[model samples]
Target: MTGPIEGWAGPASLGEGSVLTVVGAPHPVLARLGDPVDPTDPAVIRLAADLFATMAVSPGCVGLAAPQVGVSAQLFVVDVGAHPKTATLHGSFALCNATVVEASRWRPGREGCMSVPDLTGDVKRASRVVVTGQLPGSGQSVTITTDAFEARALQHEIDHCSGKLFLDRVSSAHAIYQRKVYL
Candidate 1:
């Protein structure tokens, strides 16, 4: 049920979540690998909700990871539904301990991160991918096969969980561009 916008649902247990401040580049949390989280844990679920809330408020943010918010955990939330480049929409969902099991269709595309707000980079990434992870609240193991922008967004967040940034993926300084409009 990973097709279109059908499968994901934000868990009700999170309640009204408070949006946390997004930490920027040079933050130590963003540099270190995130600790794996127990998906069903109350704190993890709350963190997922906060990530969703923070992403919703931040303009042009398609995904957000725990490290970006100063949490050192393998948790993130994604929703590229509103972007013009989005192909497959998963609605909005939070994943814990996510990993990409399969990927192909490599292509270079412009990417920006909430943590690195001042720059955007041309990163080579898979346009199609198969990702596996557990849902935040239910802790249900799920596999998602997606393509286009959705795939790119997933990979970006996964990299964040892995202590890597789009800056690390760029071929060189020539591939990075300063963002004129912070969107």
Candidate 2:
């Protein structure tokens, strides 16, 4: 759908899927906070692969966190590429237990999640942000300072790590919009 890899409801592989299942809202796992993951662990490597793969297969998905895959670990994969709205693309990358260290400016943007695909919401987010975390499978610290769509994607993924969804941050109940389609 997004790029003719497959259909939106089916597993779309950008890399290795691990054939992972993406958990949806009200599934207890979606509300659980992630524990810090050891970047040097082999499991972490596999997680990164699975996350990227799952993200690729999903239409309009730009980011995914460990919890979305039912893993209680702080890690996420993001790629602003392949998105028409993104000009400052970061390609594809994964972070382990990333934290947003700085944020500035504010804007409300429409956001939809793989976990809650039936809805979209206008959530207020920082337009610029800095996030630091260990690189997947490497135990090396990495920090990224980005603006626009990249920052919004980071905030969305990080919120998943914190057990928050765009629905929770919607300005009001009326702010939520029904999403009849994706991508």
Candidate 3:
């Protein structure tokens, strides 16, 4: 699936072909780890843009990863500024080859995914985190330190790139619940 990035028109205003069909649970690509993307590549830039677009249009979706859109690349975009639970307002941004450098404290919270639309689960996540990654086109090193909802969102998206789902981290199978609503 190597090619140039494409764009589409949407409320997110990113471009066409960016608001991709989010792959669902049990899809082979969603369960497979993603490869590192060349941040300087034009295609990667397009992917980043698509990711941002997809996130913007997805209700209650503050983050999105390459795997979710069926691209096996280590890329994701996040924006928690509009979230009511957001503690810190960081504007939307994209990253490739992201890694968590520091994490501390653990707490449980309910989480849902576009990939796993039928379910939501209670999972434990780090309360604070520091993530490092290459910026989309600049290829510059960017580090992010965040807590609360943003931290949870980051970890969730990064997990997708690593082939892990919130279902894998749920405290127990019983904690999983059917999602009747998505917004």
User: Considering lDDT, where higher is better, how would the candidates rank from best to worst?
Assistant: 1, 3, 2
Please give the distance, in angstroms, between residue 137's alpha carbon in candidate 1 and its true position after superposition.
0.7
lDDT of 3 by residue, 106-168 (tens): 999999999998899999999889988877766778777888998899999999999989999
State the TM-score for model 2: 0.88
Better of 1 and 3 by lDDT: 1
Q: Which candidate's TM-score is highest? A: 1
Deviation in angstroms for 89 in model 1? 1.2
- Global lDDT of each candidate: 0.89, 0.80, 0.82
Between which residue pairs do clashes occur in model 2? 12-57, 74-97
Model 2 C-alpha RMSD vs. true structure (Å) is 6.5
Candidate 1 lDDT over 20-56, as tens digits, reads 9999999989889999999889899889988888988
TM-score against native, each model: 0.94, 0.88, 0.88
RMSD (Cα, Å) for all candidates, in order, is 1.9, 6.5, 6.5
